[model samples]
Target: MKHIFIVSLALLSLCAVAQQKPNNEVSLDALTTETQFSSDSPDLVEFIWWIPNEFWEASFSQDPSISASEAQEIVSLVEDYTIVIALKGKIGVFGGINYEDVDHIQKEFTVTYNGTDLRLIGEKELNADTRNFISMMKPMISNMLGPMGENMNFFIYDNKKSPINVFEEGYIQFTLGDYETGTELPLGSLLQEKQCSVTKKLHNGKWSYCPYHGVPLTNK
Candidate 1:
């Protein structure tokens, strides 16, 4: 009788564990719906953008606290603002307030590649309220859009045409691209100007390329 009870308990524990396991599945449409808030406030609004499964798995393994729901929400939001240029490509740009003080700023932006299960093509941060940071982001955004446009045979919207002033905050832009096999790469993969590369594969098998030079990047 005791053996039977033990066996039942073990099975129940296994079932519970399986139920508690995180389900990483997410949807793009759920992420882009308009939230009740506006971009003018300096709050850490969740921006769930689409990313590749490999990237998502790697990121979740590193930081398990990142919720799958958050990822889905961000992707949906990005998709809503995205401009589809072709059958397989699109570009999404959106921005909201992060934090603003007298001398510092902090903001986040993301780009997605829909070819392979929500791959992240670009992400940027504007910090320290410096003109250099803004200037840096402009090229970075361009780099993210350039390769997508070239390989997918579409043109990206120029952010310079619709400039944003964040007072002490920053803005974000997201771009998407079609799936191209072989060596055809995105702007993040090639040089923009003067030995500057946009994306690089890290030693850890993750691509975090430099925004200025398309080489493996490291956080400075």
Candidate 2:
């Protein structure tokens, strides 16, 4: 735990440095392959191909005291890779297929005084009293600052929508995901445990296949 926090804070300091976004894209092929593979039912890798804080430090930086709009601007820039820090000082790497649409992200995980947590996936209403309570709570929440770990979360989006939201129809939640950062644990572990299955479609009696496990479309 000590080593982890030490590494994390050092990363926070580095990523908080301001710099021009790198022109060159970070290469997935170049990620270090030092992870131990699992020795269980499925051959999933034991370690995550995690984003190193070096990449975030290289991309851009912001002090924890920076404005919300400033932080939003820094995160909105899609480098080949990037890491974003929230106003309250939590950091998460945001990029994937939904690279361009950054609107669905609400950096502050807000809750009403009535206890209605609005960082939720669906439509949640807050009456006037609840709204007022939230306004009152914001400052108190702001002062108790502790940085969440860097590069801990991700967002996936639909390419079809002009701007995508996970709340829309057909969004699949990672079953173990129960936190604002989404999964209580890193998603790589759950994926490695999944039984690779091909989706079969019988459209008008014609059979076609879709695979969910990174399996090949064609199986001989």
Candidate 3:
């Protein structure tokens, strides 16, 4: 717990050093709704979600203490991977999540993009540059999450071979352990409005796929 707070404070200090923005330009709640997507499964006792670069960009962009250049530099460092964090606890229960469970889930995670299932790699498996990059940003993620960040472990999917344009894809799928019907994050729809590629049908930005044609929606 002491280590967590220390790391979080370090991140806050870094943010303070950046250029300031106007007051209350954007709220964390608003950003969470757009960036974080949760699963609807009632059987699982844990709360897990995927955080894309879009969230970090918007977070830094709207933060009063962070500069645009600093934000871009930080985001660009990990632009080639997929990030997901998980904690063992019920949603809306602000208490600490199990620390032991973090290690367990870190080893058992999967990410699916464009119907291709990919295994998630733990932090130790990452290259030195990427590892260093995550070390700086992980604390910021924990700081922003507050209690939810307690005992949380991050899992990464190396998509460099087949990069994922999260803003262009319909949705990204995440699963931990044997939990089927994993969380599907409608990242593209949340980041920007999309339209059907074939029919040019306009969706209300609620879904990433066309209802009729059953295909991924394209950015509008």
Candidate 4:
């Protein structure tokens, strides 16, 4: 009886510990949908994607059967920050986005974290080998991006030179020349919100209620 009681107590303790652990089961839609923002007006329609490390983490965490080495490869992929800009449709169409609009935005595009302008990763910024490595990973990243990846232009930022602890500051801002949608995005706040039960995705921080379900959105 004493031995059985001890075993039961041990099992109960393990269960308690497991319940306390924060098991964030890697929600891809939540991560991507949360960081993504778009400016859709009668005149302009464009998507600005701030791809954080958490996005990559969630991406790699999808496959449970990946080996240890594969896991390390995933870790290496998220070392730098990446931004994907996409502009759809032809230029100079009435009441639609134009190529020139997006082109100007990219020319003047800038991203800041905790008030520091992140260095843009390019051939001039990174060594030949590192640049080549980034080039090689483009296909894999493109695949991960799905249909939208076709016309997407990637902008890599140097995180190693000036390491960004996004959670520490929890503030990231974007500026795209005269674009109304470009503004400061509070990432820390989004991280705290609950995912919509129906859509399994978090609404853009503006909505108190899920747009699809019409139900109140809570915080975790």
lDDT of 4 by residue, 1-220 (tens): 9999999777644322211112145456655666676665455545677776655555555667866577557557557655445444432555433354445556777777767888776657655555675576668766866755555666777787666653443466666655434334344332444456677785443334676887655443
lDDT of each: 0.28, 0.27, 0.61, 0.57
lDDT tens digits, residue span 149-187, model 2? 222223221122232221122221111112222211121
Clashing pairs in 2: none
What lDDT score is found at residue 91 in candidate 3? 37
lDDT of 3 by residue, 19-105 (tens): 212323434464465545445645345556566666677677777788888878888877877777776544344642334466576
- Please list the residue runs of candidate 3 whose C-alpha ends up more than 4 Å from where it truly belongs after superposition: 1-31, 34-44, 89-99, 122-129, 181-220
Best by lDDT: 3
After the best TM-score superposition of candidate 1, give how far the Cα of residue 141 lies from its true spot, in angstroms: 11
| Stretches > 4 Å off in candidate 4 | 1-24, 82-105, 124-148, 180-220
Angstrom error at residue 205, model 1? 30
Candidate 1, 108-213: lDDT as tens digits: 2223232222221222321233224233334543464454323222112222323222111222334221122211122121111122123423321112333445
Stretches off by above 4 angstroms in model 1 are: 19-25, 29-220
- Cα-based TM-score, every candidate: 0.19, 0.18, 0.60, 0.60
lDDT of 3 at 101: 66
Query: Which should have the higher lDDT, number 1 or number 2?
Result: 1
TM for candidate 3 is 0.60
Position 141, candidate 3: lDDT: 74
